[model samples]
Target: MSRVLAFPAGRRAKWLVLVAWLIILGAAAPFAGKLFGAVENDRLGYLPKSAESTAVLEQQEAFPQGRVNPAIIVYQRDGGLTAADRARAADDQRWMAGKYMPKTPPPPPTVSKDGKALIYQIALVAPPDKQEGNYVLDAVDAMRKHIGDPGGGLEVKVSGPAGRDSDQFLIFRDMQYQLVLIPVIVVAILLLVIYRSAVLFLVPLFTVAVANQLGSAFVYGLIKNTDLVINSMSTGVLSILIYGAGTDYALLLISRYREELARHEDRHEAMAEALRRSSGAVLASGGTVALGLLCLFAADLNATRALAPIGVLAVGSAMLAMLTLLPALLVVFGRWLFWPRAPHVGDSKRAHGFWTRMGETVQARPRRVWALTSLGLAVGVLGLLAFNVPQQTQFTTTPDSERGQTLISAHFPAGNGNPATIVANAAQADQVKTAATGSGVVGAVAEVGRAAGKVQYAATLNAEPVTAAERSAVHRLREDVHAVNGAEAKVGGPAAIQLDQRDTNVRDSWITIPLVLVVIFIVLLLLLRAVTLSVLLIATVALSFGAALGVSTLVFEYGFGWSGQDSQLPQLAFVFLVALGVDYNIFLMSRVREESRRHGTREGVIKGLVTTGGVITSAGVVLAATFAVLVALPVVSFAEQGFVIGLGVLIDTFIVRSLLVPALVHDIGDRVWWPSGLARGTRQRAERGRELAPDKSR
Candidate 1:
């Protein structure tokens, strides 16, 4: 075992590894705190660079207003606006435009039909080098103070790109503060209960904290030097990944170390043997997730794909820490880390407790246990029939932005703040206007402005800009206007962007899911070294994924009552559920393969289940709790993602890896390891049931 060692060779070698880890942690501490500064909040920027939505954004840079943010002023008076109220609305618009946009005064307010509602659009140009979003927030705050709330039978709200962006920015910013503080508390409490020993509980926590810092520093460095982009969601998810997965690796390694302590007289050899024993499973688990996460790089949505680099880094670093830093720390601290319940020679079997009994029960009737579990999972899978993935953001309440959206939709063309614009040759301006008006979806069409020998016609839709109907109307308007003779009309706006994003997300999901499976299959083949076992593991995990998605869909629709999922949820859910779900299988099967070679097939399956079950379940619980932290975030999409992935992990841990896999392998006997040496002599496979005996003897 020492011949293939990477650190953890002896007592002195352990100290050296620990010292190196501390130095690395201390050096990375500064950069780790800077991770939040690298976050981006631009919803449009979430699209891939080459996407049509991204293209629309780029072309907007050529326009007179460029990409300036707009703060929409929506005012409504009951019983229709009086003469005084109409004049007040006009004065307020001119006042804000002059105060904020002195250089380029904004257009006049557009009053709604029935003269009850008015919209005043104000644009704010951000400072050239700023990406923090605080500039726009500062502007929004200034306006709110300047135009204090009115008390008459009139209502007013600040809404639109600037207002919504400002609110979202603050929400994510506040979330970043809570993201760091909350998950740590959750993990700490859970770890305390699971380990019982105060020092042992802190070991994984300390190790993962250091691991996250190192991973975060690397990410921050990447963003500083390259064109890499991250957002609040990035850091938020990274925190969960680092803590959840890192702690998982720690728990596995430590559990094995405790087991090895009873077999080896020297703590150093016990530590070394534990590292050698558990390192493969940890590496396999991490690699499964790392490879699956890497598939995100293939996604067309930048928000989804951006998780790849950080995820790979986080998980890869976790594997490294488990193999090196954690092992070294355990040896350095010695057996006292386990304290009052420290492992002594021959204590492994007696300490087995509940898992030993559960293993015997499972081994007794493998078919019944597995069949029942599979049936339960199938019930969860049936919920897939009710699943409807939404292609838009779902806000839980009538926030200022949504309230403004409602007013616009009710009293005027719903697309008042963000109207579809058709850019055509100036010669075809009349035909473009006529085609846009005749499209039926457009309530009003006018030549708003012209630039570089092109006419820009703005058409206000009769539907809310982000709704499916608005996107449909915009699509038809573009087709109709472009069909007019000699009119090369290019349509772009909020509706068009949403439609393009939805299309790109659907396309990306189809491409990435197959790629993810291929990646995971290759990883499993390498780890298991048997095609049959690898393929079966993949199939079981895929089924687990389907079942998890089915269950999550029902919860999101009925429990939370959310209408639609984010455009990228399907691909994200599949990648996370399949990838993370396979982690527990890797932990189980890797141990099973190791034990199968030593003991015969039946004994190996029983021993494998007993040994790995408890630690993996604890890991799963910690991870599920870690991800459920996202439900506390401001955005519903984060909550949705957290719910699905967390649910998937529990399914994998409790049902799939715990029962279905172990029992199936037992029922199949040596054929489970087909093409391997164990497959050659099936009759010699079953050994005496070691746990069922009264005494521990070799």
Candidate 2:
């Protein structure tokens, strides 16, 4: 059985593995560059197809004017806008009319009641063949360059819904550099500190660098050849996942290799033995995470579903590299890879380290140690009582569009740029108007765009588009519009879409959460082969998730000066935390089972914690640090998601895996493997095991 894993240990086999990987890397290179081209960032795409908002958005594709993204130009002066400011704003509209989107000229400009700001709204129409974001970005750049700066103490701000969105689009285009650079630098620093060996630190980095290229290229290929509609943001996330997860797998394998090398004289034999022992845990860890991520396919949200494939591709690719390329490199390089502190055939045995001391304490008073530790982590879980995920996710803090939105919202109707858009059959246009007016809509409903037999109406809201009042108004509009005898009317817009997304995501949580739990339970049960123990493992991970969420909310609220989370944050964070948090449980327990096969269950529990504690903690810290690098991203949602996952990994690492799990195993003793021989007082003969086992390896 070890022959498959030990294939890389052979002299010629290692060389062949390296050469094949090189070939794969070369072939996969071009597809990596084409990744971002296939992404569409439409907000409505995240909703279920049956949703009215989603239908309206999907139907828009058949219309010619669907290519347009609106832009708002706000000309503001401190006290009030003078004649020159108003004239300049007017000229700017005319300046853009023929030069920008000539055929579909933007309508006239409107001034605020206070007279300090002039609002000019324009529709930026993309060409028939062009991407909407790409075209909007070019037009925005031209609008910026064309303005230069409004003179005479007047400030011209390009803002509103489209402007804010376009600003983030530009950020996405430029974020690739920082995304790659930050993780590489951060991972390098952490690996150096953890390994404390120059060559060992660089090996996994080198291995992951190659793996990331190959993995990203393969995912890009999937986007290109398949019907998979991957979000552009997923690629950046995939990159970070590959490096972080790849290095983690490498660390575990190499640490075992070092231990085995100290026990055997032949480097090749030691590597083969290490591969046989470590591969099960490595494969199980990767599989648990991969399948847990796959459970996201049950989500109704497109973005959440998209993450499932991206995560699976990344994990599968990273796992293959660590199992194949990493082992080959280690085996071929021998102990030389360790450089300054290389493991030898003989090393000191029976030592006392932090984990050893911990194991000893757990053995003495298992119940007390775990109870106190559980109490401490449970206190952090109390913070979840106040955790609330908000609907609105901010893209930029200080974009001109954001400031312009505030000014326009304060003076005029807050939903100036964004309005409730209604789709109605032409015959019921009058009924549509009447229904909207009766539903407490403040503005008139007029047709803005045309389809074959249907028209679109733009109904301005009395409240801000993101406000609860506007959503309620939109909901009421939907009811009234549908009340029309034959209106065939559907209500949608910025507010409606958000309302629909919130509803859809809530539904998704209900579906995906239970499915994920079932999926994880099945995987763990198969690996551990014990029903009682698998259930216990799942329970602890679920508990950790609750505590992590509570702690994350407090940190985001107090530490980051943010009061709310993205609506999708809790669900997404749960998937990551449960899957990732359980990852440490899998790592620790896999070793304990191995030890139990040699010694009694109680003795094995201590041995497992003492042996695997350091590597698991190091792996956790590495993973946490890798995720924390996401703080470098300017997007608020990404930063929040990063912090939550990173912090959860640490909790799982230092608190859960290092303390909670070991103590539980110790206290439970043999029952952790119930219905099996080990749990029923069927103990391994330790005396014979000591005689056969090497002193250093034990």
Candidate 3:
């Protein structure tokens, strides 16, 4: 296993491995550039075919209007609108009608009861060849430009589905560059600081960059050719995962390589030994994360399910590069890459450091150390009481669409712009409409279109879109419409979509969370070859996850003043924190197990802590910082994800892995590795006892 792991760094194979990676990168570059183009951001792309909303969307394409994207223009004034303000709005509507809807004039503007605001609805017809999201974005941009700067304190802004989509598109477009550039900068700076070598940081950075390119190309192929669902959010996460996890793997291997370099004369031999020592932990870490992400395949939401393939590919690319390309590159560069602090054969190992002092402190009162850390983490769990699902306008800066919606809500019905859509059999259309209206949740029901034996109706809700009240109303609306016999009725539109998204996310959390835990536990068992140790590590990581989430909840609600979180945030956060949190433990414990064979479990724990503390902490900080880049995004969901995950990583790194795990193991003694020979006081114990005996000279 060790020889195979080290094969890429072999004397002859190093150059060959480099050549192979270059060839693959060249082939992948073209496809990588096209990944963003293949992303599916339309509502249909995120909804499964089984969803009633999806059914409505599919049926809508058969109508004459054919899945039109509505852009609502809100014209408002604080004072009651004058005749000239009304005339300007009318002229703008006429201009929009002549330009986009030449044959079908839009309905006349509806005036507010206060006479302070009017809303004009225009349905932008989607072309057969163009993507729905892109088409809406283009049309909305043109419309916004045409209605630029309505004067006299009369505000004009586009809202509804089209306007919101346009704003989201702008954020996603910026995300492509921001996610890549910012993380790369963060990782590069951290690597330089950690290594303190001018040349050493570039090898891992270059390797991970190549891995990212390769991962993107593969993802593009899946999205372009297969039924895989890829979105802007998933792609953004993919970039972060590649850089963060890939760099982590690089750090572990490089640290081990430096140690080997101090012991062996040949760089190739040193690298081979490093791979032999560290590759198992690296493989286990990567496998745990990949399988944890794979658990998302059980998720009902298309967006969540899409993360399964994206995460697997991202981790795979990173692991492959770190295990193969990075090792090969390091061997080729030789010890010179370390520059001023280069390690040489026969150099004394610097095992005692600040971490050794920490271990000694824990050694004095292990129980007290673990107890205090555990209590602090448990306290943070209380913050879960504040968690709630945020509103649809989860953006850092208020977009034009949100401002327009606010105006519309203040004047007209809250759901006037975005209504719940119902599709039913043409024969029972009237019955379905009557049932929906009588359901007591709908404010108004209007026939939208009829085609292919089906009729569609847009039912305006009494509550605001995407709110709990709106979700409840959609449910009642569905129950009423379904009661109409043989109508085959389904309630849909934006509000229903949100309701389904929330329910699916709930279902997904139940399924994926357990699956991730079970999968990780199994990996830990195999990696550690000790059931007791595996269970303990899993428990510690879970505790870390809860504490991080609890603290994040408080910060989100109180510090950021965010109304709530995204429905998918909890599941995503749990899977990532648990999977990645265990990684630092894997690095530390794997070394502990190795040291235990010679020094016994008690001393081995201390040695492992002192040896691995710096690299693991550095790796954790790198991972956390990379995820922190998501906070730079204007979208609240991304920012929340970034902040929570980043904080969780720091908690796991500084407290859980650094102090708690080591202290608990110290207090537990050899029993922590129960059933292992070291725990049984075998022949190795006699040698360990002799080594640890007090030195009379000292």
Model 3, 251-280: lDDT tens per residue?
Answer: 999999998888889999889988988898
State the displacement of the C-alpha of residue 424, model 3, in Å, after optimal TM-score superposition. 1.6
- Top candidate when judged by lDDT against the true structure: 3
Clashing pairs for model 1 are: 390-565
lDDT for each residue of candidate 2 in 611-649, tens digit (9 for 90 to 100): 888788888888888788777676777888788888888
* Tens-digit lDDT string for candidate 1 (1-698): 44356466476788888888889988999999988877666645666676554654555556675655667888888688777777877888777888777877667777887888888888776655866276776777787767677767877778876777777676777778788778789889988888888888887887888888888898898778866567777888888898899889888888878887898778888877777777777877888899899998888777777889989998987777777887777787888889778898777454567778878878899999988988888888998898655444546555667777677667776677666756777888898888888889988886656667776666778776566677778778878986988866777766676777778889999999999999999987777777787887888888888888888888878888776676667788889888888888888877776677557677788888888888999999999889888877657777888888888889888888878888888888887777876676533432343434532212
lDDT of 1 at 352: 63
Q: Give the C-alpha lDDT of model 2.
A: 0.79
Error of 3 at 632 (Å): 1.6
Candidate 1 C-alpha error for residue 444, in Å:
2.0
- Taking all chains together, each candidate's TM-score versus the true structure is 0.92, 0.95, 0.95
